[model samples]
Target: MKTVVIGFLGSILDSGGGPGRWEKWRPSVSICQHDDLVIDRFEMLHSRGHIRLAEQLRTDIASVSPETKVNLHVCDPANPWDFQEVYGCLHEFARQYPFDLERERYLIHITTGTHVAQICMFLLTEARYFPAVLLQTSPPRKQGSGDAGAYSLIDLDLSRYNQIGARFAREKQESTEFLKSGIKTRNAAFNQMIARIERVAVRSKAPLMLNGPTGAGKSTLARRIYELKKSRHQIQGEFVEVNCATLRGDAALSTLFGHVKGAFTGALSDRAGLLRKAHGGVVFLDEIGELGIDEQTMLLKAIEEKRFSPMGSDKEVESDFQLIAGTNRDLRLAVAEGKFRDDLLARINLWVFELPALRDRREDVEPNIDYELDRFARDNDVTVRFNAEARKEYQRFATSPAAVWSGNFRELSASIMRMATLAEGGRITTDVVEDEIERLQSTWRPKPSQSNLESLLPAKALAEIDLFDRLQLDVVIEMCRSCATMAEAGRKLFAASRTRRRAVNDSDRLKKYLARFNLDWAALKH
Candidate 1:
C-alpha cells in the first residue's frame, strides 16, 4: 500500500555528517509513515559495501512482504555539495527513482562525519520537502553524555515540523520561515481554552486538570502555557509528560520523583524524575485517572508539600512543578467505586476544565478541514482543491452521527492526511472521502462471519483487546455501516495488517481475507 525507498548517504566518515542527538529523541516523527519506515542508525556504513547493504536491506524489506518495494538512495559527501545542493540531489534522486519515490523510499544516511550534514538532511526532509517517502536513521547508543547519537527518522508534516521550527526559532533567534509558512492560525474555542488557563496562571496555583481525549490539542495547550510563562518569568524548567497507564507501582513514584542510584533493578545512575525536570514549568500527566491509590497518595504529598524522596534515598528532593493533568476517563465514577483516592481527586479537581471533542465542536469542522487540506497540500508540494461535492461529502461525514471519532482530533487529522495523499486532480471527492472513511473503519470491524471468532479467543485476549482495539474498531465500523460497495473496507483491512508480523504471507492473501472479514489493521492492533 506504501511505496518505500532505502536512502544511503555515504558513511558518516565519508559523507561528513548524518542525523544526531536531539532529532532522535522527539515524538514528531510519529506523524509520518510510522508503520512502513524503519530508521537504522549506524556509526559507520556497514563494511558489507554499498551495493551489498542496499541489496540486504532490499532483502529485509522483501522478506517482510514480497510486494514491499524498497529503493536505495546513496548520498556521497565526496561529491562536494552544501546542504541545499544535497537537498537538490535528494529531489533529483526522488524524481529519477519512479518506484517508491513518493511513499516508500526511505532516506538512510550512513555518515558519521559531522552533525552539520545530518542537520541538513533533517532540515531538507522535515523542514522543507515533506515527502512521505523519506525515513531518516537513528544513531548508535552513546558511550558518553556528549556523544550525539544518530538522529531519529521522522515522517514530519507541516504542523509537527513547524512545532520543531518554532522551538528552535524561539530558542536560537532563527527566522520565521519554518514556523509560519503553512499553518493557518485561528482563534477558536481552543484558543479560548488557552486564554482561560493563562488568566488563572498566576492567580491560582491549584493543579489544572485538562480533560480531553489524546491529541485534542491538550499537549499543545500545555506547551503554549509553558512558553507563555517562560517568556514572562525566569522559570527554568522543561515540560514533561507521563502516561499514567504506563506508570506502574514503584516505577510511577520513581518516574514522578527521581530515584537515587541503586534505587531499583534498572537504576544505573541517579536520575531526575519528570517532576524534578518540570521544576517551574509544567508536568502534563495524561490519563490521570489511571493512577492507582498508592500513587495518588504520593502525588498528593508532592503537590501539597513540594518535597519527595527518591526511591532508596533518605534525603527528600524539593520539586516545584506546576501540574497540568489530563484524562478521558470518568474520575467521578472511579472515585465513587473507591478505585480513586478521594483526597487526591479533591486536590486535582480543584481547577478542572473539560476539553470538548472535535465532533462536539461541529461548527469548527469545515474550518479545521480547510486548514488541514491547505497544510497537507503545501507540505507535499501539491495543490489539492475540494470540489463542491467533495466539500459537502467531507462536511457531511464530519457531522454524521455515524462518525464516532473515538480518538478525536488525532483520528480526524490522520484521515484528512490520507485523503489528501490519495486525492485526484487536486480536487477531493466524495469517493476519496468514502474510501478514507472506510479504510479507517475496516481496521476494527470484523466480517459478518469472523464475528464468530469472538467465540474462539480466550477471555484474557478478548479483554486485553477490548479497550485498546475492539471499541475503537467498532467506532470505525459504525461510521461506514452504509457502504454500498466493499472496496473501501478492502483497502483499510489491507493497510491495517500489512505491517504486522502475523499478517498473512501475501498482500493479496491478506487483502482477500480482509475483504472476507471486513476488518483492518487498526482493529487487530487495538
Candidate 2:
C-alpha cells in the first residue's frame, strides 16, 4: 500500500476551529491509505508535538513493517498551483510502480481542504485511476486535559458503481444469469411457464402479465422473460422498468407516451416516453394495479396496437415494445371493481407466472444467506467467515416465525447484515439473533391499556385485521405496550405471513389496507 501525505501543513486556523481553544488548539487526525489499517489518530497526531507527528507516523509504520513506504508529498493550501503540484507528485509516485493502463490503482487523497484535490487527482490519474476509494476522516477534536479524538469517518468505494449496476440487473433478472439458472429452479409448478412465455413472446401477440404476492419476485421474473427474449433469442429490444405507483395521471400518460415541447409546464423539449425508448425492448410496468383508470385505457390500447401518440402531438407514434406488467393485486377483482380495465386484463393475461416467496423455499435460505454474507464481506474488504454457530443462528432466524421474510430475499439480506454486525468473535450466536428479533418485536408489541380486541381491528376496516391479531396483541400487551396504529400491528402481523394466498383481484382492497396499515407483505415474505 502506498501512503501519500497531501496535507500536513496546518496553521492556527486549520488546527483549531472550535468556539474556544486552550491546550485543545492543535487537534490532529490521520486517514488510512486502505480500509483495513487502523490508525490511533488521537495518540499519534494530537498528543505528540507538531514537529514529531510525521516522524512518529514513519516510525510507527516502520515498527509494524520496515518495507512500508511513507512518502511526504506536500500541496500548497492556496490557488490552482496547489492542485498542479499535487498532480506532479502523484505522477512522480506513479512512476515507481509498473503502469498497467487497464488495471485500476488507488488514488488516496489525504487532503480535507477541498473536493478540488480529489477531482484534480482523479482527472490527472486518467484511466490509470482504477478502483478509486474515497474516505473523509473528521478533523480531530480535543476535550478537557486530554488529546484529540477522531470519529465520524465516511468511506465510499466509487469503483462499486459498475458492479452495483450489474448486480441490480442480475437481481432484477435483466441479465443472462436467469437463463443460465434454468427455469426449473423457479416455482416447481411453473416449469412449463417459460415455454408458454416463449410462444407468446415470439408471436408478439399478447402483453404479458405476472401476478404474485409482493415478495414473490414478480419484477425479477419479468426481467428473466426480457433477458430470454432479447439475449437468448437474439430479439432486438430493450428492457425498461417503470413503477406505476410513481406515475400519477398526467405524469403517467407523459411517462408512458412521449411528450412534445410545451406539452406541459415542464416540457422544455420533446421527450420520448418509456414506450418509445423501449421500442425494440421490453417495457416493464411494475405495480400495474396502481395505474389510474385513464392510464389503464391508454396502456390497453398501446398493448393491443403497439402504437401510441405523444401527450401533446396529434400524430400517432409507432413503438414495438413488448409489454410485461407485474402486480401483487388481482386484476380480475380490479376490473370487476372498475379500477383496472377488463379489456387490458384480457390482452395481457395470456402468460402469467406467480413467483414463490423465500419462506416457501426455505431450502434456499441457508445458501442465500451465505451468498449474501460473502457479498457483504467482499464489499467491506473483510475476510469474513461464518462459524457453525453463526450458520446455526442464521438457520434459526431463517426458520423462525419472525423470519417469515415477507420482503423475500431483500429483507433476508438486510437481516443477515444486522446479524453479521452484531456477531461476537466472528461467530454469530443465538444471543445476537435474539437481540435483533427482540429489537424488532419490541417496537411493534402493544401495552395493556391498548390490548383490547377493538384496538386490534384495522383502522381501514375491521375485516382487514388478520388472524395474528390476538397473538400479537397479547405479545404487545405482555410487553406493556399501549396504543398502536393498525399500520404497526399490520407490519408485525404480515411480517410472518409467508403462506397466505395473495388475492388476485382486490387491487383497491389491497392498496387501501396496505397503505393504511403501512404493511409491505411482499418485503416481509421475501
Candidate 3:
C-alpha cells in the first residue's frame, strides 16, 4: 500500500535560506527522510504566491528520498485566518481529489499551516471528508544535532482505541441511565427513545416537545434534560419550570413575559418573569397545550425572536433560553378546535417525543418499582424492602393489564411510598401488597357516569369508540338524561358557544352530534 501525506507548505520553515538550508529540519523534507515512516507521495498545498517555495521544498524532499513523489496544489484563501474561506478551499480540494482508500493510506499534515487551516484540516478529517489520520510534526529536542523532527500520527477514529471507545460507550450508557432515573427499564422502545433523547439533548438547543399523558414523566424528563445540558456546560442560568395549565388570562402573560408596575389591577411592582429567569438556561412549559391562544401567540414570538414585551411595557426584554414544552393533550387536536395556535405548535414541534403511557410499558413497571423504593429510602432515610412473596405478587399485578396505571410513574411512585411507609420492620409483606393492590384498583375503577354508559351502550360499540370519544359521549348522555327537553340540554351544553354566535341553533347541533352515535334525545333520556 502507498503512503500519502497531504499538507500546507510551511513557507517560513521550508525556505531554509540559501545553501545552509539543509542544516535545519523542515517538516515537509524531514517527513520523507524517515526510513521507517516512508512517504510514497506528498501532496503539498500552498497559495499561488508560494509556488516558488513549494517547488524548492518538493526538490529538497526528492533529494532526501528519491523514491517519494511530490505533487503541488494551489489552495489560496483571501485570508488565511478566515475559517469559512480556508475551510471551503480545503473542503473543495478534498472533494475533488481522488482518494484510493483501498490502495493508499492518507495522513493530513497539521504541522504546517495557520491555526485556522489546521483546525479545518482536523474537522475535515474528523468528518471523514478526508479518510485519513492527522500528522503533527515537532522540532527535535536536540535542535542542532541534525536530528530529523519528531512526528506523531493522531487517528480520529475512536473505534481503533478499545479503551477510549469503551469509555465513550460507558459515558453514553451512564447518560441514558441518568435520563431514565437509573431505572433498569426492560421496554425496548422506551430505552431506544431515551437514547435518542440523550443524543438530541446534548447536540441541539432547539425547542423540544414531550407529548404524553399526564404523570408519564414528561416534566421529570424535561428536568433531567435541563440538568444533563447544564452538566455539559451548555446552560448557565436556572431551570425555570412553569405549569401553563395553572396560568390564566393576564396572569399567564405576566408570569411568562413579566409585567411592568401597574400592568394589571394587582400590579404593585415590576416583575421579571419565568422566561427571563431562564435566560442562558432552559424553560420547561408543562401542559403547554393548556396555554390560552393569546399567551400562545406571545410565546411563539418569544421562542422565535428570544424577545418579548412585558405587560404594560413599550419595550421588549430579551431572554435567550432553550425551550422544552410538555403536553398530555394533543396540540394538533387543540389547534383544530382553535384552542392552540398552529404556528406555535409548528415552532415547538421540531423535536417532538411521545412518552408511552405506563400501561403501554408494562415490562418497565418492575424496574420502576425498585427505583421508587430506592428513592423512598433516600428521601425518608429509611431502608424498605418487600418480602419475596409480596414483591412477586406486586410485580404480577403491576405488569398485568388489570393495572391501569392511569397516573403512570407518579401513581407508581405514590404506591411505593405508601407501601414503604406501612411496611412493618422495613419489610412489606403479602398483606401489605394485597392492600396496596386493592387501593390501586379502587382508584382506577370507572366513575358512576362511565358505568352508566357501559350499561346503556353495547359492549362492541363501546370497544369501537376511542376512550376520548367515549368519555365525551358519556357526559353528553348524562346531560340529556338530566334535562327535561332536548333544547334545554342543548342550551346548557352549548352555552359557551352561544355567546359568540349571532344565530345559535344549539338544538340542531346537538341533534347532529347525537345522530353520529346513532341515538336521539328520547332514546338517550330513557
Candidate RMSDs in order = 28.8, 24.2, 8.9
Candidate 1 local distance difference test against the native: 0.59
Give the Cα error of residue 214 in candidate 2, in Å: 2.0
What lDDT is reached at residue 497 by model 1?
61
Judged by whole-model lDDT over C-alpha atoms, candidate 3 comes out at: 0.88
Best by TM-score: 3
Instruction: Give the per-residue lDDT of model 2 (tens digit) for 24-111.
Output: 4232233442245443221121112344445544554455445445543333333534667656645554455454435433433434
Q: Which portions of model 2 miss their true places by more than 4 Å?
A: 1-187, 190-205, 377-383, 420-432, 439-526
lDDT of each model, Cα atoms only? 0.59, 0.57, 0.88
Candidate 1 deviant stretches above 4 angstroms = 1-195, 374-383, 424-430, 441-526
Q: Write the per-residue lDDT of candidate 1 for residues 1-526, one digit (tens) a residue.
A: 3433333423422221134522332211211223544433211222234555445444433543454444444555443346666556555654554453444444434233235455555565665453542444443365323333344544656575787778855643221111212233343665455446656754565788877656666676666656655765745688888889898887887887778899889988998888888887778888888888877887888999998788889998888888888876556646765878888888888877767666666666666687777778779888887779877877887777767666676777788888888877777788897787787667545577654336434556566664645655554454333221133334444566656646444434533444444554333322
TM-score of 2: 0.50
TM-score for each of the candidates:
0.49, 0.50, 0.78
Kindly indicate the candidate among 2 and 3 with the higher lDDT.
3
Candidate 3 deviant stretches above 4 angstroms: 1-4, 15-25, 32-43, 58-71, 77-107, 119-133, 141-147, 155-159, 446-526
In model 3, residue pairs whose N, Cα or C atoms come closer than 3 Å (at least 3 residues apart or on different chains), thus clashing, are none
